[model samples]
Target: MTVFDLPARLDATNAPAIEQQLLRLIQTDKPALLVCNFAATDYISSAGLRILLLAAKTLRQQGAELQLRQMQPAVADVFRLAGLHGVLNIQN
Candidate 1:
């Protein structure tokens, strides 16, 4: 299992950077499972959601699983509002 700790905020300003880093991890490390730890993440925007969706898709294609964990209420709500709570593999 490989875990990536996300920043407090995931938005348009930094989603691309995070995406690149995650892609590198997926390509180089090739972990069977990837966990995006949102314990410290308080906010996430549409761009962030886009990145997560992309990551999930890429990981799936690689035969790896992506799990979103420890999401703060606000961030979780964002996912809920975006209807991603069902699309993404999220855990409390």
Candidate 2:
């Protein structure tokens, strides 16, 4: 498993760069599990959600898993509001 600590804010400004980095990690390392720690993330915009979904899809295609953990309530709520909580693996 590979654990990635996310930034405090996930918005359009940085989502693209983060997406590239995440994709690179998935393609190069190909870990069985990729854990994205959202302990420090207080906000997640739609762009951020898109990145997560894309990463999850890429991992799924490779037969791996994407696990999101330690999310702040606000960030978690964003996922819930987007109806993504059921689609992704999220842990307290």
Candidate 3:
């Protein structure tokens, strides 16, 4: 299991950096479970959501999984609004 502590703001500005990090993880021989801790994240833009979805897709292709945990209310709402709860594993 590998975990990433997401920042407080996940917008277009920082989404790419996060994406690179996740991509590196995917390229490595890591565990199947990748956890993103969003305890500090209160906002996430569409770009951020896209990154998450991309990460999830890549992990799935690698026979792995992605788990998002401790999401703030606002961030969680964004995910819900995007109807991504069905595609991603989110834990309140």
At residue 57, candidate 3 shows an lDDT of: 91
Write the residue-wise lDDT of candidate 1 on 1-92 in tens digits: 99999999999999989999999999999988999999999989999999889989999999989999999988998898889988999988
Looking at model 3, residue 32 earns an lDDT score of 93
Candidate 2 lDDT tens digits, 1-92? 99988999999999999999999999999999999999999999999999999999999999999999999998989999999989999999
Give, for candidate 2, the lowest lDDT window spanning 10 residues.
72-81
Candidate order (lDDT): 2, 1, 3
After superposition, candidate 1 runs with Cα above 4 Å error: none
**Shift of residue 18 alpha carbon in model 1, Å:** 0.4
- For candidate 3, write residues 49-92 as lDDT tens digits: 99999999998888999999999888889998999999899987
Count of clashing residue pairs in every prediction:
0, 0, 0
TM-score of decoy 3: 0.95
lDDT of 3 at 69: 98
Residue 33, candidate 1: how far off, in angstroms? 0.5
Better of 2 and 3 by lDDT: 2
Measured over all alpha carbons after superposition, the RMSD of each candidate to the real structure, in angstroms, is 0.6, 0.4, 0.9
Question: Which regions in candidate 3 have their CA more than 4 angstroms from the true location?
Answer: none
Error of 3 at 4 (Å): 0.7
